[model samples]
Target: MTTNNIDILGLAEINVNKNMLRILEHMVQDKFKLYFTTEGKKGTGIRFLVKKEFAVYVQQFQHFEGRIGFIDFYTKKKKIRIIQAYINVQDKEKPQVKRLYKQIEHWTNQCLNSFVKDIIIMGDFNTKWNEYEFLDISHWRHDIFNYFKKHFIKESTLVFCDDISDMYTYIPNNPNHSHNKIDYIWCNIDLMLSAIDSKPRDVQPVIKTDHRMITLDLFMDDIVINKNNTQKCQPSSKTIYCYDEMQKTDGEWNWDKFNKDIIEYLDNPNIKLTTNKIRGINSHKQLNQLWNLFRKAIIHSAKCNIKQKKMKVKQNCHPLYDSDLKRDLNMLKGMLNKIHGTKLDFNDRSIENRQKIIAHITALYRRSDGNKSNTLSDFISITKRHNIIISNHFLHNKTFQYKDILQDTIIILESKYINATYEYKKNIMNTFIQERNQNYKTDKKKMIKSVLEQPHTSLSIDKVYKNDNNKDTFYTEENEVKEQTNLHFQMIVSAINCEKDLSQHPKWQDQYQSKHDVQHTIYSDLMK
Candidate 1:
């Protein structure tokens, strides 16, 4: 990376287990600072190597084990966040792989809630390069890419810059051997201005490596506002955890048919048992030891037999507001309005006015920022009280005006309003999130009901046969194999598109009953 003058490098599929991954993380270097999959991980490993100069600006580091992660850097009044991912090689149709895509989507959701404007995601996505077109609906519209279609990712758009290329990252030793361009670099609208180009590095000796390095060059000065002249917002750190191994117990557990399922989970050799210090379980030393052993057995079996979900707990900072945050956000919004109304021609174009608007936004971001309960989600989203999807990009081109100052500002702030009818897009987005969570909490089984009621036929075969890290699945042909995915869905996830256990799928219900006929529901007797 240093030889290539690369300041930041992302390495995916490091091909090491958790123990080895931990060892590599400890083996530090002088020149480059590393961010590894410390928590919330799966698969192999993904890491980031940042030159010391840039590494000093790193505000936070996070990742999803062997799959994806990101590093946040604050420099020159701009936040340059790099999200690195290793999309594993697997059948896309499985529910487990879909979990990976959903996890990516979840990570992107975090990006939107951020106060920082420039976000870049780069890594080996494992997209079927030759099988798809850059602009084809099948490619971006597919559940794989999800929301990336709206923003410039691998392809260039009139609004954003991307170095279009047909170069492949996977090269074979023999020239006749097949290869593919599976790696990609994506930037948000703000970073698009600084994106010089993204392309594959020169093909190296195929015997030395199968995958070539990909790089993106950015004109940092172009995107950054002078930090000396700008007021900085106190950055919020979003905590990361590895919950992918935890089971999702939303759907009812079928005790009658769970005998063989529980046995399979318990018998699996890969089940890792760790002894952590416990409290309040039992006072006696012997009983405490016995209780811990029993608890471990139960949890290990549940994780293997039931569905598991890998997720990053979202940071909610609204509670940090001391009645002052709300007032400050309103004041910031009004100040932004005054700038446009006072001067029609020069207001939006003037760098001073733009800087003031940025300051106001940052002020709101830092309001009551007593370093408590804050997170990386864009503060704009939660500062408001209402459900709306976050809106379009702001400041795409020269002079950074979207159609004009008023329209551009509205695009960023007015997602909640239908036809400019009401409020900030952030508020609207937060409203939706809150509503979804409330609904899920009110009815844990609602997701199961919704999943069962939905028209399964309407969904494509790929959608119906989903992938998840559960052993009870029966929809696919590869049932006998031991498969694991570094992803799990929550209650809202199940409501959206959660797969049912083989015993619960509507079509197989009748046939599986006979499979269920001989089995009986076993209950633990508390009275005894």
Candidate 2:
């Protein structure tokens, strides 16, 4: 009943609310039937909201293709038909828009040819009337405008408007913005005249909403003449029944073909076999139970190992570990470990496992390279070699036997090896350090143990040396000087803590001392 020309960005920001519902309620009356169309990423979609009483009778709803939102609502009223439509705009310069208009025209004409007696088309037409004065007519695409005008006045009967005061439904609210009169309500001529004969009132404009409410008051007495005057509906009952039967049969046939193809593919020796063949037949509840059990087993195993390492580090039993360092290592392992049993299965494994591996690899690659330029395709190719190994083993199972299976397996393995050797080498090097604790040497191990035994303070010489091998005699001497300067800083900090009033503390003296010694020490030793 109400249609506004909504700016795309503004529309995105606004949340759907009770106010929107209130507007819709005023438009659709007693039947409580509402149909709405909106544009989304995939294109336009139409939804119907019928009151529960009428829902059982409402058969089908469809949106026309190639148009932004050309919706058709088909309903049977006392064995008669009615269709409500919302057509799209045609922009001349865009061939695609013009093509959509042609499609709507063809579709509308076909619908009019059918048995549908009552048709109501409403919405923003995105065209201007003579009274509208914002946009220049010379600059406007006249050809497209003319086509719509011709179709509107000639093909359909226009509903009379009582109030024509405000034609501009959409005001951009900017001084430089263009304005136009583009909204309308139209009905079939035959239906309009019959309703008009009963002395229907002019359409009234609803407040707040832009579009005016158009109503046709129908009398029961007038139906007697309309019944006798009804044209022979083009689609006979037999023809409609046959069309429906064919559609049902076609759907069944397509489903059967799809099932057969799936079965053949599962049984084939050439394609890599998977447990999906068995799992696909099981009920969803059963599959979920198995999936959950597998996930728990894998997660428990990974967590147990992580917890043991943390306990060892906390007890000062492992000299190689720091609490913070152990936490990070456990976190990384937890992230890489696959928790779901469903993820390890051969068929579902490809997509889920691939995503997990990609995420892991991408994070590592970014950390190493300082950018995301590393190709995921190279990593994916490497993983495919593992897939080939699984595939060869699956084909050699007793259930599958093809004469050329071994030959095909050999060819696949050779191709995988050629593509993935460099990638495999890189993956091995990166994962090798975590595979075993290779960084812990005897001296370094002792250093970590010494640091953990003492209470937390500024990092000691031994603690820093455990992590950094470049620190030799010169580095240690410089660090010792830095450590002594830090002790002097701690004494000054302790003196400041004793003063209740900040002003009582010698601010000038403290500032002068800090500047004289601290700055001099930092610049003379470190900078030089």
- What is the TM-score of each predicted model, taking all chains together? 0.41, 0.28
Q: Which residue pairs in candidate 2 collide? A: none
Model 2 per-residue lDDT tens digits across residues 354-454: 55534533443343546543322332333353453333233224212221332343334434433454365567767654433443554565456554666
Candidate 2 is scored at a TM of 0.28
Which tens-of-lDDT digit does each residue in 1-528 have in candidate 1? 656788887887765566766665566566778777644344457778787767878999876645777887776546667788777655563555566677776766665543233577777777755465555546432555556755434432222323334467876678987787777777765456456666667746522567877777777665445456666654454333333433344334333333555455545544423354333335688566755655776665555444444555555554322234344433434444444454434345677766654443334334365543221124334433333333333322323342244333334443322223223445776886676677688975655455456554342222122445764453433322213121223334554445668765777886645444344533234223
Native-referenced Cα lDDT, model 1? 0.55
RMSD of each candidate relative to the true structure: 30.7, 36.5
Q: Please give the distance, in angstroms, between residue 526's alpha carbon in candidate 1 and its true position after superposition.
A: 99
